[model samples]
Target: MISWIYLGIAVLFEITVAFSAGNAQGFTRLWWTIATLVSGAIATFFLSLALLDFDVGVGYAIWTSVAGVGIVVLGAVFFQERLNLRKLSGIALVIGGVIGLRLSGAA
Candidate 1:
């Protein structure tokens, strides 16, 4: 239970790092670049904690899926990125897969 919490936090931080990376402008922006690096390290640390109990494959899949979905939504909202039907359908598939993975007791 607690491990899942850690995993969730890890996913959030990973998304933060990824979001900031875009604004980092190829690491030219000092603040955003530093934010990216710091958040990435924090995310990795939390993931390590999660891996202590969870299966690596399962944990990693959940982490990436959650972060990927979050980043996509954030991109659409914050960056004014387009969200066409195909992209939305893809997100739905990823969400479905995540739910399936969870229900299968893969994590």
Candidate 2:
């Protein structure tokens, strides 16, 4: 569970890559890419540790959807992102889709 939290940290840095992509140039782009890749690798390692009790396939499946939902919530609350009607509706859909995927054993 703690290592899963570290994965979330890496996801936040990955989001930083997204934010930097448009504005960062040449070497900066390369650096951000490196940062994203390294963090992602470390995150995966930790996630594996956290999932020792879980099946690899299912653990990854659940991680993807649940972390996705966590990201949106974090963006809205911590990032002070505006939750417009359309955005809120989209978030609703994401939540619904995640729920469907998890419960249907598709995740």
Candidate 3:
């Protein structure tokens, strides 16, 4: 559905927000801070579009879960962050929860 596409785009932008915020270093860095704010706005815009067709609770859970997973993976690959077994297990649990939510037709 078009709403799902919007949600996906929102997730990507949310991921960008996480990384940009990290690089912002307490908002001391101008460009990264600006990037964080801009990405957050874009992400919220698409999320709003998606929520027009989705249950708000479902849409929000999916958005945060997917973006959190994306941020973790990207952090490992790009920022030399740890990808330990416990974190992987947590990721799996989050994924399972998302799948369950989808199967329940809640999103």
Which of the numbered candidates is closest to the native, going by highest lDDT? 3
lDDT tens digits, residue span 1-107, model 1: 89999999999999999888989999999999999999999999999999998899888888887899888888899889898998898799988987887788876
**Between which residue pairs do clashes occur in model 1?**
none
User: Over 4 Å off in model 2, which ranges?
Assistant: 1-28, 78-107
- TM-score to true structure, per model: 0.88, 0.51, 0.93
Model 2 RMSD, rounded to 1 decimal: 4.6
lDDT values for all models: 0.90, 0.60, 0.94
Report clash pairs, candidate 2.
none
| Candidate 1 similarity to native, TM-score | 0.88
Ranking by lDDT: 3, 1, 2
Where does candidate 1 stray beyond 4 Å?
none
* Consecutive 10-residue window with the lowest summed lDDT within model 2: 14-23
Model 3, residue 104: what's the lDDT?
86
Instruction: Sort the candidates on TM-score, descending order.
Output: 3, 1, 2
